[model samples]
Target: MPIGPQPHGRRGTVEEPYTPLNLRLVLAAFGLVVCVGLSILLFRMGWTVPGWLLAGWAVVALVDIVVIQFRRRARARAEGGDHSLFE
Candidate 1:
């Protein structure tokens, strides 16, 4: 397929392999796992304060992802309303 203006139609994006949103979600999930796992390991190894601190960082990343996705949607809605960009 040519990388022109419209790479896809209205529906059937989930079946597509290179969807941008899916890629972002995968990266975010990986980051969450790494942060949360490190936090658990620290807590188990007799580190109380640092473990909790690492957990807090993980929480921050989660919140950041939510906020960023929300803003992205809102901005897309405002700019000429091209819903196809989301899909």
Candidate 2:
């Protein structure tokens, strides 16, 4: 099928095989980097000895798990496998 702009003021997007998985992965990685950097800065400045780095790592890990699950479900649904994406 032709993947192009939709009519009206609606956002343009493909129906399938072109979900935002790649974009989500990129954003998640960027968030992880920012979290670690901020944490280090705060620690070095003596403003707080909080677990900034650790917190950032945790956020990245959590998001990774969620993204993986979402992609898996999408694939399963598209393939008409013996599983429901909503389930």
- 69 in model 1: Cα distance from truth in Å? 1.2
Lowest lDDT 10-residue stretch of candidate 1: 2-11
Off by over 4 Å in 2: 1-19, 49-62, 69-87
Q: Residues 36-66, candidate 1, lDDT per residue (tens digit)?
A: 9999999999998998998988897787567
Candidate 1 segments exceeding 4 Å error: 1-30, 79-87
TM, every model: 0.52, 0.44
TM-score for candidate 2, please give it.
Answer: 0.44
Q: Give lDDT tens digits, candidate 2, residues 1-87.
A: 332222333334555344344455566667777777777777788756465655667587667857655765565565544532222
Give the distance in Å from residue 37's predicted Cα in candidate 2 to where it truly belongs: 0.7
* Backbone-clash count (model 2): 0
Whole-model lDDT, model 1: 0.62
Question: Residue 8: error of model 2 in Å?
Answer: 26
